[model samples]
Target: RAIAGIMVTIPEYFAGKNVLITGATGFMGKVLLEKLLRSCPDVKAVYVLVRQKSGHAPSARIADMVNCKLFDRLREEHPNFPDKIVPMSSDLTQPELDVSREDQQTLVDCINIVFHCAATIRFNEPLKDAMQLNVLATQKIMALAHRMKHLEVFIHVSTAYANCDRSVIEEVVYPPPVDYKKLIDALEWMDDKLVNLITPKLIGDRPNTYTYTKALAEYLVQQECGSLNVAIIRPSIVGASWKEPFPGWIDNFNGPSGIFIAAGKGILRTMRASNDAVADLVPVDVVINATLAAAWYSGSQRYTRPKSLLVYNCTTGGINPFHWGEVGMNVSLV
Candidate 1:
């Protein structure tokens, strides 16, 4: 069903519910946070897991996040929007997510929903680092979610290219290239140089460590969803905002956003891509909407669909398909 159909009363579903979000500083995470705050004004609280980056503390970072232009509408409407957002100092790369005991207990007691969006998106990231952040971190989060007494839904954000080894991608958890457990055990004692040397062979036909680890992470998440109301959202080549807060409200130079910017500035003169290849560019707002709706649907249908993981292929190609040739033409015009 469409997100609009599933979530007829979006605010009613979210009202008085506490949401815990990871990667609240990232592009999609920020938009998710904004939508929850702006649309679900009655939401009890939003707890964000953040680590100190650069010289800024987690609280300082979240303060800066709300102050960004993305939250302008929320700020104008509800000047106290920031009050509902509580930042918990936590590191995804660490064991148990480095969430303090007090914060962990608080989350266990109060958090009603979780959005696990924190992941290293760098395509060229080292295998060990990617596994640590993407795979192990997810495992830790799942463990935490299992302990959450009041948890209603657990939404994990994965990429559409996770199973890109296959052309026809489906909304299901496919078998990973390698057994994640064995791979993690092997990498434990292996030298970094040796791992780097064999990285290409290890990844096989997959493009990068990012997708490879994400696939492993999905497998792990599926395995751990013993009794949890789990849902996975796989968004393809997320681009600038198409609606909601504003159009073209993009900050980072990752994915298509970077390409569009480089093309506009004449930095990306030409690109090599098959004309017939699908350009599955999904808007950030649409992805967030689907994510929120998935959370709501999971909770509402808990009895009807007990413990079954719902995988949403939040892509545009299957519905409104576009080709890379059109993208090139548009970039050229830019």
Candidate 2:
């Protein structure tokens, strides 16, 4: 049933659609890029917003990106698949995201959908840096999306733990402890170390600045209201795929999953998390598929309730209910 639905929906609906995916170099982003290309072969173009890193040009980055093993299937199908990939150079931290006027105009004229996945994923990122990348970057993206004349949908890939302070998290935007604008202002003026030192006090109950700022980002999206067709996909800790392409094929050993790997290798000693605590992990492919579906659904079903933003909590907690101990055991075995 799932395979039939994907076949019926993807190419027929997504073909020739101009998509702009940020953070195309990241793990989840790579998976998304591969899936789209392999599944929707005729996709008009994929405009990936990438920053020039280590003196490498945008074109060079694109060249390196397509050559990755993730795009092996696409490479085999269409060796010239690189042509359909338009790499746009833009820095997230800059005002207007540093996108050139000409490039911005090009995006406005052509882009139909946007996947905003770029962000500082580090749990220990400085508060100021976190605000700049996670919060301010999102604001800048929203501004750019507003100018996209042909934009149909804007999907924000937010974390499900953004509302972790609450016991039973809901599909809704929870207010942050600090005012978004005030926090931005404070971080702008204060020293990085000072901000980092006070972060714990500032973000009460919240584990780190990452989740706190992400929650603020959701609020900013809500501020968009009637202006844009938006969907907030709050996915739990993304794990190895259950289907599509392959299973248990993970790359970077980051997040809690990294801890599991370390524990399995006998590298990690003591653990902090409770053994029986629910490990809310949703597969990367599932999240990508759900995001694609949500983007389509959100576009067709416009929200009439302006006060409430569309939040879909994608997690196994409500369904599978796997625990941390189970995850540890699985990692050890696999």
Candidate 3:
């Protein structure tokens, strides 16, 4: 049933499977890629959908990603690990993900699994940009997934804060604040100034544009479940690695990583929080593992399971709960 506590058949599920991954260069995405390469060694190929960033090509970026310290163990164990990671130049914000005709055809013909992780995570991002990257891009990816000749599973990565307005979170898609289609159509012709004026009201009780659009994106993704195998993984405040490639492996200052860094630097003097409020800090590796598990389940259990989108609320609050008072104390000690 399990090998070293991991499901024995999970690795077998990915064997010789062609995986198409978006956001391959992001925090969680990189860890997901590494685990797949290191654990699922027999995987046919990992097609990373990337774009030209900071004047560097996708291939160059991927080469640098594989050389990072996170993949040190993997590189040492399997020197040819990079061979399976194939980078395909594409932009999520563009039509058809800005993938070339040749690459598009290749994806449609061979890609068996899809991981849509690319999105604008900035909390202060403009509504239009967030909608474009989060909502519209998701729609485009779903359309593309439908065309995949051998597609078995489509895993979408969303944030746990997507429905933060609600106190009790569950593994389900909640109603959006507004109709996604109507909002998209209304914002089509609105100028930047007018949209900005109404942005706060549009987002309503939600904290930021990021969560708002992400919720809408989830709704849109669910609409495509009838046509393809779909699963959504909502991770809460993803922190550094737990025990996969290495311990304390973190690259970005996005969530708790930033707070930890600031505390270490002695820059974070004081913080305010309800002492008893639950701090849901799920590690990046745990999220990736859950993602892979979801993929395997979607593929192998489709026939036995009901015909509906699977939503995995990958959080640790209910199981191993930690409070902010304890977190602050730990950080202070550190």
Worst 10 residues of 2 by lDDT: 1-10
Worst 10 residues of 1 by lDDT: 1-10
Superposed model 1: Cα runs more than 4 Å off: 1-8, 332-334
Write down the worst ten-residue block by lDDT for model 3.
1-10
lDDT of 2 by residue, 42-157 (tens): 88999999989999988898888777666776678777778888888999999888889999999989898899998887888888888889889999888889988988788998
Q: lDDT for each of the candidates?
A: 0.90, 0.81, 0.90
Winning candidate number (lDDT): 1
User: What is the Cα-based lDDT of residue 69 in candidate 3?
Assistant: 92
lDDT, candidate 1, 1-334, per-residue tens: 1244463377888899999999899989999999999988999999999999898999999998788899999999889988899999999888788899999999999999999999999999999999999999999999999999999889999999999889798788998868999998999999999999999998999999999999999999999879888999999999999988999888888877887788888888788988898999999999999999888888766766645688999999998998988876787675
lDDT of model 2 at residue 135? 87
TM-score versus the correct structure, for each prediction = 0.95, 0.91, 0.95
Candidate 3 stretches with Cα past 4 Å from truth are 1-8
Give candidate 2 misplaced runs (Cα > 4 Å). Answer: 1-8, 300-308
Q: Alpha-carbon error at 102 in model 2, in Å?
A: 1.1
